[model samples]
Target: MSYKLSRRKFGQLALAGTVVSGLSYLTNRALAETPSLNIVGIGSTPIITTDQTTIPEVNTTELDSTAPDSVSTDIKPVGLVLQSLITGKAQVLADKSTPLLELNEIVSGFTSLSDGTLVVAITPITTSRRQATPTRITFLGTPVKTLIVSGLKQNQQLGSLLGTNDGRLIGLVGKKNGTPPIRLVDIDLQTGEISSISKVKFPNDERVSNLAECPDGKLYTSLVGLNGDTTLVQLDSNQKKPIRLGQLKVNGQAWNNGLQSLVCSATGQLLAFGAMRYETPNAVYSVDKNSGNMTRLQDFDTTQITRARG
Candidate 1:
């Protein structure tokens, strides 16, 4: 079979082939660069205690070297649920509910360091109140290292842990018995010491429930009132106070539920786990930083997720 093609025809065919190859290269490059976000969540079932009348506090001050070699006798075993989600999706990709430390500890806070190391604050369950032991900070990895928080007061507990882009760990410290003031502080990863940053003055009835740092290095927090009203506030590092954005709204209607966790993806998308009303299962939402609007993404079953980090 002998077929002769003109010069113009051959040129057209060559150009078409080049265009197809270029398109394929571009597509592959995009896919390689834009990896799916990996969000991790840690939670647990409610802690139940058999003792009611007399409660005892576990002396955590002595057990601060590393993760306990074995589960303490005072611990009432409960499973700690660890789950993961991909970017732009609400469905959990995997639910590996492993009983780390025999599920004897309650996860009070969870966040990732700048190098993607998972850090968790857990308190050993000693009584029904769940407040008889000091909260210890631990790193989750091959060998879990439990570190003692040196500067935290006996009545203060740290929550809403946020790892900043500049490699600093920040958290919200609140009182156990009385109303909590807006106290933001920086925590030392090596020494487990905490130093006070400037305090944000918010309303007495409202508290800074959750905190997240965006890709641009700006910090945002959710102010939740006693009536379940949530407002998004932006904290500027240059200033001492935070700028109130507005009340959070879903589909243009005011959101009536509280946001359990707030996290910003590497792609600059703000995500949250919100407490929906009417007994509906908790769901994930994409938050609008400018207007305080939330768009529901997908419904997730876990309700006790203290925080999520992407």
Candidate 2:
């Protein structure tokens, strides 16, 4: 169920003056404290890869995980909003019985502060829909604090986002009109300011489908080819080009570039959510960093459920 953000929690989030820094929820001690988390396998989903990243073999059903010590804190699942095409609002299915957050602006995407606080990018409810305001809010209440992210231009629109281990926010920058060069931009979470980091020029008009920051201090993005093949690439500032990691395989078949979303779990696992083309239900899968294999955990129909984040 949904609950209000407590005063103690609100006081903990002061992003205006002091810098906010901490680990992601998955890497945080909260999820680690759990004695053990079991994963039920659904046979072997092999991924052919020569990359060094390790992909553990485990499978589990669709799980609704909560904060470890949430009873006293009234914490809720980190929400990822999927805006409806018709209504232009977000809906999440974490707690199916609870109501969704009725946000006022178009939610571009969300990322977390180092301290586990969530920040959202929204195109403000004005006539112009170019730049977005980075916002931090009380999960349960109506108090929303908007921070002025500096250097964001009027022609750039923010897209999918992720928080890094270094306490920075990285996102895709799409042009408001024509096909401007696709680039990865960084946001100073402490200052609410944005800046261009690097240009990710993918051939064949392939854009960043999903992006996440791993525990090893590297950034990864999923790129789909024109032939429907999906490749996982790494963003290395030291290197001159994006390192091609490997291809993502689903159910022993080449995944046809339909990855709905990808997020790095607290424990460093690459969690992916996608539905097959013309498939009735959606399933959750985990990507092995070392091997590009994706094993299906469980498939469930979310026809009634909307958007989920965190």
Candidate 3:
């Protein structure tokens, strides 16, 4: 029961042990800080906290296959879930949270104002008809007031809504004219007035699923094509054609149900949320703005999520 080793061998072994121990500690700390979010229903708000790590991550609640299919393109989102990355909890902004207001319409877009007021674009339950009404809600799901956007005709469905740094809202809208062209509209927070910004006719007119304003003032959005292919694109004002970054490729590509949401992190990384349709794992991936490659950050052990509170 005696162990003997040369000075060099002993030094190498000690260094190896120290490296392993350091890695183990950092790994454990990360695990403890990452929030395990379980969104059982539409109202389950899982707050994401910054105390654990700087990178934003999300988790979803477990559900059975029989769980309601809420990720379909035709399905209108009833409510919004607001999750605070700094706090790591989600506020379910649904009927249970705001019982007075019936959130049965399609939530076209959501963004937070400069003063932290959550703005939501809501359309009719059936389809995009005329002008969709916008509402301002508090972080706790309380309805503050509603803004009537003018000049937007009836049947115009707002696609992607984003709040810019200058306290203005930018959104993608369909005019519902003969050939509805998706255009970007600048919304006035005070008057609820929408002014035409740019007519964005994407390549092949790819339907935009979501839009997020990056830290660098560029618009990043997710586009879904007719072939069930999803991609990330940059909608810059100076560029006539939208810049195609790359495909939002995940490990379980076949299992991904649909694009749920796309948000930009504080550090300017795009976070994409995908719903699991079949027997697959739901995941939240950090997307590369340049390459469109998705790096898996956290796996959600859940089925479907209605929407998050803005």
Candidate 4:
């Protein structure tokens, strides 16, 4: 007495639902100019290169270094989050169970393959998560690749993974204990492997927290000055000396609290970074990568911008 829909009716309903989703997305985007289309204190927003068009998607912890997955841009009606936030569903990974990969056993350095596949740089660890040894980069069935040194390994708790374009892996930009602070690590896209680069030499020796590669391939870093000033730094594609871009200030506010994270958009025009503030919800703002200027893009009243009734 309950099941009444026929196969033909079900197919029609599915198609109708997709159309409705598409329409709702369009309706929501029309008012996208209102600030608050973003989340503060979360992670960076990523826009995957599609055949055409750049869509805003939010990065969730699930897509963090913990899993090998990616969501597509320019391919969907939309998602609830801001990433290349392709609103519909999570992108499929070649191997669902592939483990997380970190840079120098500390930072996360992950990037997508040319076809948008996620490359994970996992080291074989004890079930308890102790680092026994790091393995050469290779997908489970792929041929042996040279991304790891035979007998050298370290801790697995310092850094989170970073993802980049196909040929290159995500590099590290953080400090290492009991050693001169190392700033960056390079990932080999071909081998799913990682290699340490050089530490940034700052006369002031600022405590840098995170680094992000903008769509233009320029690595933007979040540096905290010794004097407790939070600022933005732009590096040459080579990631050498960071040219001081000054602390990110918006609407007459000082960035003394510092940036919690950094992310950039496809055109490099929209750079988003999170500010660390305990009392208020985190803040996400857009920056002009070239001029180092920032615009207020979000705040706690975001629901005033995100809540919509269709």
Candidate 5:
């Protein structure tokens, strides 16, 4: 549905911060008003920061009224999916792969707060001649406050944001230029500052894909090897090293394609979106936290989704 604010409301939003143009302000409000458990995903698209005036308004379409029992009764269906394309617009998907809203900036990762508000990690576009820009931590609620994250180097970017049960915001910071060690960090929501927690040392040729926090407060990560072998690892809260869980198995065999996104539902079920091979159709899988075995839940289109949070 189209969301247009009155001129008075527009003035208020403009004064608060750089207002996100178009229906995003009202669309976000609509999402906030309705309370439901949603699984959010973001696509991998390079975005560069530009003048606000040059950005176009966000495009939106009517949402599907029927929320189908697509995935399963126990788990929530994929609700909001954000994809950044070459057009510099972010598309939101609801039930089908249909686009609902088009945003100006690229959303790399997002997590929900205790109050159901969303904390999003946005990476601004970088030009070939310029160094990478700092990722912005945006709180999507009433005022839509945004903060430039500090303590990240020029070649580093934060993804896989997870809001812990105790209210701590954690993220995985990875290097852009080379395969440097990926570090887990605590992000200060108020100050947009980050402090190192521990470096995730993967086995030779293994790289981390995403991170998730379960209801019981345990953290998990999906690692991909050079041969496309996928492994699930657990990060103990008090320990510096990660414990290797098994390879993510499907039908008693290792899932060849890596899991692009990992999220733990409120019901304590681990879920992920991955394919059997690269550039194939994606499917939702219920992951066994203990054994890393996966059961297929639903299938999706060939659209490339990079990260997920529930």
Candidate 6:
């Protein structure tokens, strides 16, 4: 989804890629105070690491997720991705029947503000390709509506995007003719305003494949492998050059390099990427963020697992 600027923030230049790359619906009024949420994990498809950040659908065949609490906000999943070809506009699919959140083209992506208030990115009415504005809902509960902004404009079209603990900044991608395919944006997390620190692009940055941010707000972009390593570079705001590392890929795509993901801890632990074959059931490993050591998170087949976009 895209975000807002009072000038009409056309978003989704906000949606589309990391280079690229879900479902459940259950609505209940006053679900806010409900004790336990009824959730299901219908399917767990392994989305292989690609050049883009992939948001997997939360398949709900049957699950028992914690219901809406005071802090619990229900954002119905609408599976969507932008096409590189751009012939047709990107589409979102609400595969479920009655969802908690009702989004029209007027809406892009949504994230929760830690405070009680809802801050959103809105798409300006002037957006040519899409209809929705990237705005935030006042309350995700009964009578859901958008929180208003003062003097918001159209340049804000690349509306507010939610972030993951892993450091994926979910906002719009703004592109111009001959420019790099994607532009990284920072969301204010409040008021839904776009930051002057708005766009980020790398040299020869073709399409952003997969991106992961560390707990420290440092971001790592996953690129198709070149040379000896499946690469993920660390960007330094002060320095022009990035710190580079070589990740080992167990998946077949690493024929040229290794499959990679990066993680960092505030306490100074540094965990680089490593993978083993997942025989059908995948084994997860946690790298020592500070030491670069590997520890197991879950056990699965590195071999049974698949390789993806180089």
Of the candidates shown, which would achieve the greatest lDDT relative to the real structure? 1
The lDDT per prediction is 0.59, 0.47, 0.47, 0.38, 0.56, 0.32
- Please identify which of the two predictions, 3 or 6, would achieve the higher TM-score against the true structure: 3
**Candidate 5's residue-wise lDDT over 137-180, tens digit each?**
76644454556678888777777777777777888887652244
lDDT at 127, model 3 = 48
| Cα error of candidate 6 at position 253, Å | 6.1
Provide C-alpha RMSD values for all models, in order.
14.6, 16.0, 16.7, 14.0, 12.9, 16.5
lDDT per residue as tens, model 1, 109-212 = 67887865567776554546655545667665434445656677766777778878888888887764324675888888876678888655656677776778
Give the residue spans of candidate 2 off by over 4 A: 1-105, 124-143, 148-155, 176-180, 199-204, 299-310
lDDT of 3 by residue, 221-287 (tens): 7666655577788887888877788776666453234466676654565767665455345555667
Estimate, for each residue in 1-310, the C-alpha lDDT of model 2 and write its tens digit: 1223334543433222111222011222222332221111111112334787753422111112342211111112212221111111122311111111222334455555554545555443344464433332212212333444456566656656666677667777665431335677786644455688875465436656557775566677777766667888887777666788888887678887456556665456676666666664665566887678987654533211111222
Best by TM-score: 1
lDDT ranking, best first: 1, 5, 3, 2, 4, 6
TM for candidate 5 is 0.65
User: What TM-scores do the predictions have?
Assistant: 0.71, 0.57, 0.60, 0.50, 0.65, 0.38
Better of 1 and 5 by lDDT: 1
Clashes of 3: 27
What is the lDDT, from 0 to 100, of the residue 208 in candidate 3?
A: 64
| Candidate 1 minimal-lDDT segment of 10 residues | 17-26
Ranking by TM-score: 1, 5, 3, 2, 4, 6
